[model samples]
Target chain A: MKRVVILDPLWPLEESADVIATLDVTLDKAAEAVGDDVVAVLAAPEQRVPADLLDRAPNVRLVGTCSTGYDNLPVPELQAQGVTCIHVAGYCDDEVAEHTITLASALLRGVHQLDRFTREGGWWPFPREPRRIRGSRLGIVGFGRIGRLVAAQGNVLGMDVVAYDEYVDEATMRDLGVEKVDIDTLFETSDVVTLHAPLLPETRNLVNARRLAQMRDDAYLVNCARGPLVDHAALGDALIHGAIAGAAIDVYPVEPPPADEPAFGWPNLMVQPHSAWYSPAASLAPYTRQIDDLARFLRGETPVGVIPGGS
Target chain B: MRVICTDDTWPIDRAQATLDRVGATVEFAYEVPAGEDIVGLLTYPGCAIDASILERVPNLKVVATCSGGIDHLDVAGLAERGVACCNIRNFCDQEVADHTMALIYACLRGVVMLDGLVRSGSWWPYPQPPRVVRGARLGVVGFGAIGHLLVQNALGAGMEVLVVSQHAGADEIAAAGATKATLDEALSTSDVVSLITSVTDATRGMISTRELALMRSDAYLVNTARAALIDHEALGQALEAGEIAGCALDALPIEPAPPEEPARAWTNTILQPHAAFYSEASEARSFDNPAEDVARALAGEQPLGLLQPVS
Candidate 1:
């Protein structure tokens, strides 16, 4: 029997007929379960696998990560150690897309503020400033699966969607009926801009001061991608100086950004604690897919979405 | 002159008493009073008041409305025949603003869809998805009174707010503690962009396909402004292509949807019967001045809610 070690902390698993979990895995509960015959290691993209973690689990033959982005994995080392690697991609695309819409709509409609005002005992009665969304342009910064999904949803709501991706050609955009504008035009014309590109060497800080400066005065920025795509300090300055209108950030430079941090002081910024990825329904997708993939892999059947490279 | 008040309709009786206190004979109408000269029209939408009925009043000098919108009236032709027109535009600001928020929330939260799903026995196990509103960016396309109210409401919800109004100034927005962006900026970055501005030549079809392409694909749009502000076909294409997440429309380029229109079949979009500003409180406010304005104008006083000459 294969002994598998699970590392992601957010989900709870019931002891199943075939698989047993490494129970109570935490920093304080460390070193309690160095099983002698570990065959598989389960983890998430954000987590750092224990050092000597591979060697510590002597019988471990594979590492299965819960994310497509495998930046944390030392691929060459794992391959040299004779370990197979697995990654799950496109699992929570719709879920994250829906969440993106929810946040975006809430931002536009002033749902939080209105609900808060209503809950605060009529401190602010009377809608003081109402705006309309009709006749507005919507720009998307990336055109990946999730980005495309978001655009599709926006289209359903009667918005014009323009998209830009360095790698995607105009023909592809034309097929999608998307305007293939450069980054500067996108920044200048869009009333709402959302980030969806992956964090890569070429894509980091894509929304820098210069790009931010190109956006219209009343524009808003939303970041659900990695935080490195935006310079937080520059964003704060932009909001403070009224360079752009306001911003809603679901990802951050640092997770659980310090509670006492002064960066929270920017009046025109909205920050969610880096949690745009998981909704209850979406959380189940990858888990179920993982279980099914595991079952298929163990049965010597080809599993869907198995990353091609070994280790 | 004897004025008739319908059952439970506008407190025309109270208005009548006010009129009679100042010396005018008023009668309650279970039906349109026989042989009565009903000069001013105070009818609701979908009510029957044909042009032939107007010919009954030989001494009719003015037509007044007990509503903000005057779609029920033939204003142009009536004015051509020299009938002075009046309506009620104030007093419903808060109620209309509240209605706008309600539509916005309903669209963003998928309230209607989730409710239907749960009631139809497909509960999906989880209660409808939980969406976060805090720390999102809001773009208000029009900075009129209602738009400004929404901005304040968005702020109270902990959302970053921006205003896109050609009429407004940076100092005015800054004083309101909001960032002022141009319409272009507001469209691109707003997670949601709502319309609350009056429709004018400069504003008609403002959100063209070119502009819509500027918005982020994940964004949602809410429009409580005039329908002509957006290009509906462009919106339909955008929605079909997923250029935007979803939309909630309070106005249609064509009212009553003509039964054979494509808009009637759209499921993801939310379409109100264009009664967003017709709440109970709004109705009362609508009744206050217009009814009196017509009565006063009949008695030769200044009309309330009167429009200035269309310069």
Candidate 2:
């Protein structure tokens, strides 16, 4: 019998057994797709499916990642070899947006800082003032699905919501009660600036030293999108010099940031591990959805989440 | 007539302007000056005001506190002595609601824990996996201005909210875009339960050992109200035993949590100084409203924040 390899040890194999049975494939947790009997290989966002996978698992017909980003997958190379490459999209949009809003609120309210202050026996006059969420300006760097959701949430909290996205028109933003602003204006005026843009070569370091300097000294920054979107070093310097009130970042230039993660010592900064896209309800969603897609591909049906270029 | 502002941090200038029109001179003082000329006294949440205060200033006509929570002020005792008591309200409602939502997000997304994990040289697989906020059920334990505003905030963010209130009816809770639930049900089912209710006789230590035992092991508790609303020992035990996933506390049993604060050692808890109800604008309102109320009371006008004795 053919086998499917899931590189994520935490993958809900027992819960996914029904789907595996339907496809008539035995799913096994593996460190690598080295067996010729492996017809399908799947990976979590942090795991990598090397481009040379086909060299070992020659019969592999499907390669899927249980995440929105496929940076770890060689889509073009896999598709050229007649392999169907897929990635789960739109599964964690709400989670990412919620996390972004949470980080923004934490910064504004000084929840993290106040907590530390209290534990340290310093209280009474709050060293850092907690800001009001209502009427505070929330500027979104990307007006994509997740960004739009964040704008809606901020608007509901009575915040002045604005977004900067060249692809998203002003009228569209207005429909969601969001004001469309230029990127420079977003950085200059927003009380809280959050990044929801994808990580691309052109988009990398979008928040450079100049952009950080553009922000109000009392303003805050939140990044739950991608790590490389902002210049990590610049953010550290800005924090050191108190260029901005504070920042909350979930992603980093390096995952599981090295033992000497400089962010730990940075004052007025909140560091979050890259665990935003999770919840018991949505925890198995990506895996189940991907497996269902795999089953569809097995039945000669088009999978819903095939990579654009690969498809 | 003279008005004394007991809190040194209070900007007496804002209140002095209002009193100036009424021919009342207000000044900051360390203690209540013993004199028939003192007509009014302005205090903050930390100062305990009751009938005993009348002994210090026998001719005291009114007392005002620059905070909504009147737990520190004995309204009934002061009212019995023919003294009008006013506590600031609606001034920081939005700030409290926003901060509550922030803590809710922090707990559900495990941002605080995740941040600690990253700093401790760990990363994904998330030591504390974040939960999806949109569909997560939030149990709000009050129906006051802040709780109602929080319901709007949560619903706007697409969270399923369950409100447990003795004051609000099922229809009223439902009208606010939240489901009405019994305390047990809310505790047993919700992903996060927030306490925004005041600490009345029936509410003080409301969340005790039995109550903590009702919560789902994976659930969290957030308190932005008063520390007395929960049993500190019970909460610590619950956290130590993992009876609940975690908790975020804005109010501690002791303000400026002493060097030996037990909660600091509790597992998966986020501690916040009593700084939830704050913002530059809200802070000004907190001081301005109380000052104006005291001025009104001195001017032979009914105070807007008059706390009528609960019959």
Candidate 3:
């Protein structure tokens, strides 16, 4: 039997047994793959699959990561050797959009800060008075799949939804009930601005001091995308100086931010531990989708999750 | 003619703009002084109006309250004295609906709990795993204007909605894209349940020990309505025993919650300072509508917001 190694210890391999029952593959959990018998290796977002994996398991023809972001996977080298590189995508589109809306709602309604305030023996003239969600302007920073979903959800809630994306045209956004605006207009006028852009060299630190300064003092920010999308120091300073009202972030500049995280001290800020893409239904979807794609690839079928085999 | 405004926070300028048409002037006062010149009395939720107030303002033609609820007004007794008892309605329906939905999203997504978890320097093993919002069940406990708006919001978000209302028929609920359910069914089946009902003899203490026991262990309860709708002691027990996962309360038995409030120490609860029905627009409407109704009564036209019109 061919071997399939899983790099995540808690991957629950047994749950995917039915999906791979037809293939003569034995699943094993390990830090790394080895031996000529190994045909495939899978990993979670946190577990890195090194580029030299082909050196140990030369016959390994497939590699997959159970997440949308393949940052931890060394894609270029593995693809050079003709390995099928795959990562789950669109698996949690609804989840991330929902979580983004939740964060935006929390920031607008002052859910987090007020909870702490009430606990610490304070009351109204609520240090941060809750605002109306309906009619409040919602500025979406990226108008991709997830951004469109957020715009739809925000529209249903009666929020005035607008978006900014250089790649997407105004008519497309307007068709989705979203107004197209420039990045400066988004930051300056929105009651809450959310980011849904992919991380790249040009997109990194997209929300720097300049963008933060352009935002209205009563406005809020929400980021569930990559951590580096916003300058972490600028976010903390915005909250510290009351330049903006509040923010809710699910992803951090560092995964599981180190102890003594400066974010803990930022007033009027809500921190989440990179869990925006999670839900009971979504937790197993990425893995199962990846495993099914691997099974498909082994059977000479074009798999859905294959990342293009080039840099 | 003079309109006496007893609430210090009332926007007299806006009210004067309305009272202008009826040739009535508005004045602020700590109490309604015994004066025949007082043709209208504008009060807020905090100020109670009984027949005894008639002895102070003998010429009062209308007693108007800047709130939807008329619990503080002796409507019948005041109407017997040829005084119209007017209270604003439908002024903050959108605000309440938006706030309730925000709390619902906050509860299901576990943003507040996760924020606390990250701040405590703990990551990964989420204290409570965030759940998916789309396809998650939402139980709405009332079917008034606010409740209807809330169902629209939830249904728009792709949530399966189960509405419990004594007055709404299944056809009506289904017409609104929701299924009708009994209170017990809603409590047991919903992932997040919101209470938006008024307090009445039949509804008071409606969610007590027996009702709390029927809730799912993972369900979240949201109360943006009157605190009397729930039994505080039973709710505290349900949360501590983990019978119910958590609750988000925007109202409490006491306003300006004292330091000893028990809900403060309850597990996985979010508290707000009874701030659900507020927004710059909604606030303006609440005050302006009541002031306009008072002006209407003084002008010999029928007042729009009268709980009991003078015979």
TM-scores of chain A, one for each prediction: 0.79, 0.93, 0.92
**Candidate rank order under lDDT:** 3, 2, 1
Candidate 1 i-RMS: 13.1
Candidate 1 C-alpha lDDT tens digits along A51-150: 4666567766666667655655665567667766677788667655655655555445444343323223322222322233433566889998988877
Question: lDDT per residue, candidate 3, B175-273, as tens digits?
Answer: 999999999999989998899888767789999999989998999999998888899999999998999999999889876689899999999999988
Residue A36 lDDT in candidate 1: 66
Q: Model 3 clash pairs? A: none
* CA shift of A144, model 3, Å: 3.1
lDDT of 2 at A261: 76
**Cα RMSD of predicted structure 3:** 2.9
| Best of the two (1, 3) by DockQ | 3
Tens digit of per-residue lDDT, candidate 3, span A120-195: 9987667887888888999998898899999999999889999999999989998999999988889999999999
Candidate 2's C-alpha runs over 4 A off are A1-14, A22-41, A48-61, A80-83
lDDT winner: 3
Most accurate candidate by DockQ: 3
> 1 or 2, which is superior by lDDT?
2
| True interface contacts reproduced, per candidate | 0.04, 0.92, 0.83
lDDT of 2 at A263: 80
